[model samples]
Target: MISTKRVFTSSPFMMLICGSLILALALGFRQSFGIFLKPMSLDLGYSRETFAFALALQNLVWGITQPFTGWLADKYGASKALLIGALAYMLGLFFMAKSTTPLGLMLSAGVLIGIGLGGSSFAVVFGALGRAFDPSKRSLVLGIAGAGASFGMFAMLPYGQFLLNSMGWFGALIVLSITCILMFPLSLGLKEKKIPLKEKRDTRAALTEAFHHRDFWLLGLGFSVCGFQVVFILTHFAAFIQDHNLPLTIAANALAIIGFSNMLGSCLAGYLGGKYPKPYLLSLIFFLRAIVITIFIFCPISQTSVYIFSAAIGLIWLGTVPLTNGVLASVFGVQYLSTLSGIVFVMHQMGSFTGGWLGGMLFDRTGSYQIIWITAIFLSILAALCYLPIQEKPLNVLKATMQPIDKA
Candidate 1:
């Protein structure tokens, strides 16, 4: 006799472990990218804007490709997508390490790696998990998986800096390339069958519904602010700190501080997602992020200020993720969760493009980051207001057709 309890709990735990490890590596390595900007630019003789554009393009590519990848994961399985993503990741890093020209850097870093990240990271992984876990446990499981990314960001920031100092940018990238192969085996653990009959719905209908939904766009718009706020900090905050005549270590540690706090915060947020109104919680997070950014920028700049800001920001960093997922799951059922969220992610990445590319361009034009920092604050406030109007009820269509067959 198959013990459903054992099967559900044990299998989900294993999948979480595997999914968490894979995401940790993917997100961690990607998050540490800022440390290489100065070194790569100096070595290759490119302007900061040029490098920033490549990263901006990368985010855009990731956003555009996410829907397709999410669809693939939902249709086939995450393992196959992970397999392809791993190859692209390794190959992209290899080319990035060898590239000596700007175009080559864009192709390797922006296009290929973007493809790799889209397929192997959170969307594909959690999309698979969505079908495996019970609805009651879904958000919590997603939250646990989301925390893995924060852990990666925390663990990789300092190590990436160390690699830059010891091995140089090219050598560091090569080492990272080699480390990416672990995604294959780890991804296999996520190869799960769909949960016992939940709902069988047309993916197209789901897409059509979401496109027409008011709150869907609201969530998408709000998420874009999150993308803008986080990416601007991740891609440029270190350099901003370095420009202050502070030690590079302070910048790296500052990022790590955000990572550590994000891990704790993400876990807590995931737990809270199960118990609270996800939209309200999400609004609270955005409001808190705005407050932290405002305080840090207002106070005198110092090592102490930087660390405090990082810690405060980290507490709310990826906290929005589980809440975001929770909202989607609540609003739209799980059958098409991955694809619907993928559409939302596209908006988020557009914001990422603006944040990453615009930051570099502004600094190049004005020689200051103050404007961009202020922009992040205003956008955070705007996003907070946006989330307030979202209704978290299940879709009306799902309500209509979800009843069981007639006895006759």
Candidate 2:
């Protein structure tokens, strides 16, 4: 017989470690793409806008696929999805090495990698984790898992830079393809527990019901803003730093600082998410981002100030993932968390698509990123206000349907 006490603690810890590692590999490799922008553009004779559009397409495709990927994770299991994602991710990297034209980069880096990320990223991985842990421990586990991305960002940025310098971009991509293979081992630990056939049917019904609710739309809209802010910074920050006449190392270090600080931020956000209202926590995060960006723009540009802004911004970075997922759990039961969260993530990716592409377009047109930073700050404030009216309660339809009807 399975021991109830042992099941609660030990299994979850094992899952956490394994999940974190997989996340590290998946996110770390993708996060390093910014380092390739200049080199790839120079070699291929493509404009920065062309590269940006491909990356934008990547984000858009990922966003478009996320809901389907989430549904697959919810219906089947994360292991199968993750395994498929890993293979696709590796193949994308391999093809990226051989990419010679804009179209080649679009298919390899944009579509394939985007699909790979949609299937393999936190939407699938943490969705599984969300189901594994109870509500009490869910936020904490999600936070730690989210931190894995930050860890990847921290380690991979400089490592990617080194690879670029030592080996050419193609060689660096080959190395990353091998690194993507590591996710396969991590996938082995994510086993799905069997649900009763009746429960499975009800879960599907619940998901359908959630789609009819207005709150879900609001939640998705707010999540899109989070995606926009993060992707914009991640894809463009390195270029932005370089534009300022700062050393490339400064950009690398800045990305690393964001990753390093995000570890603490994600953990803290997770802890607080478990204890507080997730919507409010999300609002606070957005509000703080506005403040951080404002200060970053107004302050003098120096290595010290850049690092400080990056760290401060990083602390709030991806902290939204835990809370956003937490809110989904609060509204919809964990049974369909992956699918529902995936839909929300799709909206987030829409924002990501805009941010990545627009940052480049604006820069190319104005020869300045100043306008984009200002726009982000304004949107952050608007997003903070958007969360104010969200009711933390579950959808009324769910409560009504789940409760037994009274007999006359």
**Clashing residue pairs in candidate 2 (N, C-alpha, C atoms within 3 angstroms):** none
TM-score of 2: 0.93
Instruction: Write one digit per residue (lDDT tens) for candidate 2, span 225-305.
Output: 887888888888888888788988898889989998999999999999989898899899999999999999898888888
lDDT of 1 by residue, 10-50 (tens): 37778889888888888888788888888888878988898
- Compared with the true structure, all predictions reach lDDT values of 0.83, 0.83
TM-score of each: 0.93, 0.93
